[model samples]
Target: MTTSTGQPLAAQRILVTGGAGTIGSHVVDLLLEADAAEVVVLDNFARGRMENLAEAEAVGGDRLTVVTGDINDPALVRDVISGIDVVFHLAALRITQCAEQPRLALESLVDGTFTVIEAAVAADVKKVITSSSASVYGLAESFPTTERHHPYNNDTFYGAAKAFNEGMLRSFHAMNGLDYVALRYFNVYGPRMDTHGLYTEVLIRWMERISRGEAPLIFGDGAATMDFVHVRDIARANLLAARADVTDTVYNIATSTETSLKGLADALLAVMDSDLKAVHGPERAVNGVTRRLADISAAARDLGWTPEIGLSDGLDDLVTWWRHAAQPAVAG
Candidate 1:
């Protein structure tokens, strides 16, 4: 669980909101494995599942404590922040959900941010690493998107929510001297991704389709692409952000390699050893990104973060997990 640099990010105590999620669970596992003294996981099961923490609990033993609660509860957030050295804030509603219920979704994000950041500042927590999204770069003006091109590229409620979170963090830092970092994660793919959503990650849907002997569905032309970083890599980036000597800045957490939907389905087919071809579907998205690839140079230079799993290796791990996850045990 030590970083790739071999340095342990051992903490006396840690609090991870949404800790029972796809990426959050991996963050918990890595934190426990890296020898954190104690870790408290808080989740409401809105989009989180207890099964996601089974492996982490098995490894962490008494060192891990799970709490089921709402992140929007200011008092609850305050209580959870007490005596914690670090916080990884991953609680959120999905973009599709945000689009459907903008009022509730937006309120949840704004309310949750105030609760977590206020509690952290009140408790004098050492650092907080928050979850941002590459969707903030809607229709990028250039390839290799960087943090500087944000607010302009923000075109979705989901993206705006993340950007608002970042702005709050900066304001907190400026006013109260809160230490924080935000990672703008790109299209993350791996095991345990939420499989029930209508807009579930294309890769997960494709895997399920292949399992059912159905052809993978391609929405856009087979050419639109995204930077699909593994969830494990995303988890590792959080650790790096927590342990590194940087703050009040954002970093792009991605592999910087774009994979077309066709390429992804082909990769999955190859990995699954399936011969099924992808079926073409109507251009489903009203305003979908045609391409996105991040510039991870800042993460590398600042936090010593770089993705270790290549697409094929990541796909192999994902397929293995998917095959075992035939039931809905893990969270999104």
Candidate 2:
């Protein structure tokens, strides 16, 4: 989707908390593509890149504004929320990294969420859509986990934080008049996803190893599955949530299909045009029930949003971008 030369955002002032990360940047892009009046990006640059902001600004023209700040800062969050029509809060420490730093995870995920909701309510923002995660469902006994699934065992601090935040969202919606939407995103992969050393996403790690003619590493039985949804589809869902007139609610934003690690390895090999296979490594023991996929029927019915990008197509785009971005000329 392309925005007009100017006035891409038409008139609504949309604030994207953590707007410079992988998923958040795409949300900013889609919001601008819809021609919102203004797109305010709030980021601390702790885990986000400057280029993500630059990309948003380039496409947003004058509509994009970057606030280099932390979400935990109530003052800054309130200031950004003031006069904004909608808030897409996508800021948080990720799952793997949060596991290593449990305390920081709680601060950023749980406390930061409370901060955003409070600020949004204070600013009287019309709508708020915070990013949730499928991790909230720890291990699903069923194949396609629905929103009605039993509360998670909370295998990690990250998942526990999300669970706590979901409770907070419900509380805010009930007591205050804050309209909110919590989207439980599945395994998201697309362009601009994190590939930092030892902090890369699983799909990204697989792609990088395959690019270097190395066999991808797999832990456990490689049978555990995840419903991988593309960031573009997630971006569209965020826009839909903001535009739709709805009360506080939660929805699973995912492709509604399960892809196991073995399958993912095969897909990557096909993408890279390589014959290297996956090598089983020492499986890190993780607590929690396994098997996860999203039952997104509620999302389709309520938000009129469904992820259209398939894993293969999404991974293809991601690998292509990664390959180009990995080149020396492109790097500097």
The lDDT for every candidate, in the order shown, is 0.87, 0.81
Q: Which residue pairs come into collision in candidate 1?
A: 194-332
Give the Cα error of residue 114 in candidate 2, in Å.
Answer: 1.4
TM-score of each: 0.94, 0.92
Q: Let me know the TM-score candidate 1 reaches against the reference structure.
A: 0.94
What's the residue-level lDDT of 69 in candidate 1? Answer: 93
Mark the regions of model 1 whose C-alpha exceeds 4 Å error after superposition. 1-8, 197-199, 328-332
Clashing pairs in 2: 8-35, 9-35, 9-36, 9-37, 10-35, 10-36, 139-289
At residue 243, candidate 1 shows an lDDT of 81
Clash number for each model: 1, 7
- Using lDDT as the measure, the top candidate is 1
